[model samples]
Target: MTATDGHGLRADAARNYERIVVAAGQAFEEAGSAVTLEEVARRAGVGVATVYRRFRNREQLIRAVFQHIVAAEIEPAMAVETDDPWRDLVSSLEATVEVLAGRKVVLAIARETRALDLESMRRFVATMDRPLRRAAEAGVVRPELVARDLAAVTIMALATVHPRDPGGADRKRYLALLIDGLRPAPTVLPPPSTPDVHGV
Candidate 1:
């Protein structure tokens, strides 16, 4: 079974799983998702069989890597909160943008594998719920804005990130504009084209 499946793995197996994920992250950073499982196995110092045992396919390994990166970089931003929900929301969005923009190879893999990312996106949207709710309650953001809307806002901002510009100047500019749109406003939003799959 995979790392998250069935019972927990034994200590040795758990170490291998972690190694494979870490190695895959490195490989993906260097080579994108097209890197072979054998290459990841080599980087992890594990046999190919071990890699196959933990992840049935390349897609599975990429998903694991995606989850690993999100946990390492994004979840911390999601968890931090202060008395000011608007500030908290803005901080979290900035962190998210920085992480995603800095990892261009990871973003390319994620874009190529979008068909398999609905569940991951659902989990991400769920994490934004508390901040969005608090922002609306505090009258800092429009009540009509939802967690899914924040997800879209992030996507819109990320689209402006320039690969050659390590500082992400354009990303910050567009993100600030999108953040302004979140402020309490008289404009009524059209019904979301896509429903919130995680149900808030």
Candidate 2:
């Protein structure tokens, strides 16, 4: 998977870039965000100068790794057959959790650094539109449910993936509970509230 930021790179440079990102993803997953550029260079089998030439700083490298994860890991979860909309939605979410569960520290760094690619996020959200709409039409999910809501729920469920629980039982349990909330409810929820950015 190519980084969203990659542009006009020569063939050798692109290969080096891909290697660095792959190495960085593994390093971040294993050792958290504190792993150094030199370490990433060593892991990539590239010189430290090569890493420096590609990414000016740690944040840049982290953002590229984040983008790579989104492309390689998260995006594929949504590519499902449309024969069963509800099943597709659930499978997509479960796949997302499976990809994310082992990389909690990398997730924390992504949030802390705001290393999100909004355009890529938008594309993923768009992929959910058809399944979500079909599920609502079948009355399997609440009509009010939207793609952004699923995105938010996925983020919420990630917190349940404890480092100690290698099996991810708690993550599955909590995510199941959250998914249950998406079903049509007897009582209607109050209108959703938007937090005031100016107040914050």
Instruction: Name every residue pair that clashes in candidate 1.
Output: none
lDDT of each: 0.83, 0.79
- How does candidate 2 score on lDDT? 0.79
- The alpha-carbon deviation from the true structure for residue 146 of candidate 2, after best TM-score superposition, in angstroms, is 1.7
Model 1 lDDT vs. the true structure? 0.83
What 10-residue stretch in candidate 1 is worst by lDDT?
Answer: 1-10
- The deviation in Å at residue 72 for candidate 1 is 2.4
Candidate 2 lDDT score at position 188? 68
Q: How many angstroms is residue 97 displaced in model 1 relative to the true structure, after the best TM-score fit?
A: 0.9
User: Which residue runs does candidate 2 get wrong by more than 4 Å?
Assistant: 1-8, 117-127, 194-200
Model 2, range 62-158, lDDT digits (tens) per residue? 7888777767776777777577878888888888778877677777887787665565466656666766787898889988877777777788898
Clashes of 1: 0
